[model samples]
Target: MIRRANPADEATIRDCAEQAYRRYVPIIGRKPAPMVVDFAAQIKAGHVHVAVDGDTFQGFIVFFPKGDHMLLENVAVLPSAAGRGIGRSLIGFCEEQARRGGFTAVRLYTNEKMVENLTLYPRLGYAEVARRTEHGFSRVYFEKIIGGPGA
Candidate 1:
């Protein structure tokens, strides 16, 4: 099940992000941005969602609304829980949220070094929109048009 995250979920969220992103440190030469996010603030802003199996959290996704679309700021799945479709479910939740909000699309960015995501997003119907460096990190941006054009 997927649900909005609460303040009490902060630690689990942080732990999940750390475990999920730790492997990328060697690949990217630094911890990924999602590893350092403020979960409390994100929960307070109502932007965090967790995919849970009973009481255990399997993954999470955080997003911010941006007028015509929503920004998918983070998506992390516990390494132990990988290959279980949790990450894809969280993304589907984001699409549901966007459609309910009357947004046209969902936008997201991944570090250039996360090769898995570069391939996965496209298969999920997200088109690469741009690539740039910001805050010293090379980023690739993507957008998935939801519902229909100009939705």
Candidate 2:
């Protein structure tokens, strides 16, 4: 089941974050730089959403409202659950909510080493608008116009 995450799912989200990003931390050369927000903080800030399969949390996506766009903070699916379209479904949900809320677009950033998402987002209609250095990693920024061409 995919739905808005409540504060009660903090622990599950934290575990998911740790397991998903542990390998990438070394590549990015930072302990906590790549992931500044932990599960507890994300829940408290009300930015975390999750995907559950029979009470087991399989994936999550976090985001925050910014100006006329929604900033996707992070999106992850467990290794065991990765090829099942969970990540794609999560992004679709985000886009639906963004458009429903009257947001013009949805934006997100990913590191260069995360090549899969670099390809995935673009293939899903997210256009790479810029790249920059942040917290010691090269970040690729992308945006997808939601309502239409002028959106």
| Per-residue lDDT of model 1, residues 35-72, tens digit only | 98778999999999999999988989999799789999
Alpha-carbon runs more than 4 Å astray in model 1: 148-151
- Write the residue-wise lDDT of candidate 2 on 95-148 in tens digits: 877877788799999987888778989899999999998867788999998893
Which number leads on TM-score?
Answer: 1
TM-score of 2: 0.89
Worst 10 residues of 2 by lDDT: 30-39
* Model 1 lDDT on a 0 to 1 scale: 0.92
What 10-residue stretch in candidate 1 is worst by lDDT? 142-151
Off by over 4 Å in 2: 31-34, 148-151
Position 36, candidate 1: lDDT: 84
Q: TM-score for all predictions?
A: 0.95, 0.89
Model 1 CA lDDT for position 51: 94
